[model samples]
Target: MLRPALLALFLTGATAPAFAQPPTETVPLLREIKQWVIGCDNLRNCHALSAPSGVDEEDYSSLTLHLWHQAGPQGYLRLRFDHRGEDVDLSTLLLDGKPLGLELTQDLHIELDDQGGDPEVQSFGGIEDAAARRWLQRLRNGQRLQLPGDEAAHVSLSGLSASLLLMDAVQGRLDNVTALSRPGKGAASEVAPRAPAPVLRKFTAAAPLTAEEQAGLVAAALQAVKPEEGEPEATVGALTAQQAMTVTRYDCAAYNCEFDVSSRERQAPYKETPMDLQPLPLEDAALQGSVGYDEASGTLSYFYKQRGIGDCGGGASWVFDGKRFQLSEFHRMPRCTGVGYGDWPALWTTVPAP
Candidate 1:
């Protein structure tokens, strides 16, 4: 779920409807354009356009979108739009692999089909007609669109009028979006926050966690819990040697899938250097429950909480999808183990960027 505090961000802004601006006289002379060549799925005139069969517009999540049109007989126009609460100011637009110079006095947020395909290019009388045709035509193709990225492109005058007029000629408001409906609020909610990934080891030559340091870690973990609820408190088993420890193999279907989680007790710190004892405890921080993971999208997430001396507590985690096997998350607080918290000098990690 999205953080409740961020709800305010999704609320539409109170900006007044833009006033109609007269097209600059020079615009009538420009011919470049910017647009997102959408797949002709659910389009009223889908059968009219010459396209490969079977590559239906219905199945795709990505498309090539750009904005850079050049100056021509028509005046260059820049296009800008608000995207996910951010402004996309583009100087150029790329439509169907072609480029064009653009200039936008006001923001123009519109959606362009990112579905992979041979971008159709024909001709355009100028930039003004191109923009109008580019955006207005979406409705006829059975889709209402908002400005997407700032990418721009050059428009073929012949295709510009045909496509734009086709869009303007027909109108149908999409209510139930299955395969061809325009994206809506429900679409936004489907977005998921990415889980943490396995990260590079950061501890090189660091002092082991002392009794006090272990306690500090427990404190930090508890504090990180949001809303002050579901606090994963430290437990004695977490600091005991006989705490529950399981090592199961996982078949992750997606990236960032955690493959394994390992935990064991240690008596003394390892004699080897910190780097040599990676994904293990080498310090004097007695801890139980060390999280472990195999594959990571990026940063590895590791945790250790100790309740007392000669005891350590921690766990490792990785991203795992149910493609092959799945690793479950710890739903309960960890117990203490007899393992000395020392030798805890190392943890699962990956290199980090600046």
Candidate 2:
């Protein structure tokens, strides 16, 4: 089945790597958006500022762009305003080319730059949960979006053909915009109807992170928790390390959390590091994580959900049980400043103490 699917995808120009690895935030999303075609004129827009959701408004019109970039525990992630004009388009949330019905506008949570001390997050129309799920189906399966960002949104996979299509889209737009802006260095070349050009190129392979590399990132995230003490043996996600996390409660699930950490108001920008996490350390760790050991594997499982404040504005949760683990972090990547949420990656799973 996998081989047939792979072959069919190649024939249809929808191909990616067999083992497409997880990606790291190395470049800003905007940096990948070489150029944009807005409205009927295919006008080249500047400061396209941010990535906008596609609106099926009969044409490829540009919308008021909103840009966001935030730093994560290790790198960063970018999320942009889904604005295509006035109303947020739900098509942005749709599963491209899929019959599945999904709309990003189903339940939107918008956070503006400033709203007093509190950030502004407008919660409203959003995509159907089913649609979101379908959109993420490929991702959950481990396929990654190719580089050049212009490739079909959330593609199943791709190789040279996919890469060329994206490169052409980007380069073509650039050429168009350049011709328009430069307007005839030869005085008469201004109206040369822009050169009709197309360049074909092979897709280059992107670097895939190793399990150990991902583990390092996981180890860094565990350090972000600002607790007075952390379980050095705790685990989450796919990787594990000699680490530390907080102990919110020893007998939590069965014991009603006798000890509490409800005093100080939660503030964020919880930074991760290679250093051990301190329990109740900076009041910056959104919440302390706890580990439960099972004699079955002698590995410690961890669980905790936390949100950041100020610069680091996002949240994450950790869950690990020895042999297997999952480190899921969240951040408002669109507003990616030095402080952004959903920027961290979890890569660790607990192991027996040596």
Q: Please report the candidate that would top TM-score against the real structure.
A: 2
lDDT of each residue in 127-231, candidate 2, tens digit only: 333443333333333322321222332322213122222322322221221221221232221211211111212212223334554455444444544444434
| Model 2 lDDT, full chain set | 0.26
Model 1 agreement with the true structure over 202-309: per-residue lDDT tens digits: 312223335643454344333433432232433111212221122222232222222232332322221111111222222222112343323223112344454433
In order, candidate lDDTs are 0.25, 0.26
Per-model TM against the reference: 0.21, 0.21
Clash number by candidate, in order: 116, 51
lDDT of 1: 0.25
- Residue 8's C-alpha lDDT in candidate 2? 27
In Å, residue 171's CA in model 2 sits off its true spot by 14
Kindly report the root-mean-square deviation of model 2 from the true structure over all alpha carbons. 19.7
Cα-based lDDT at residue 143, candidate 1: 23
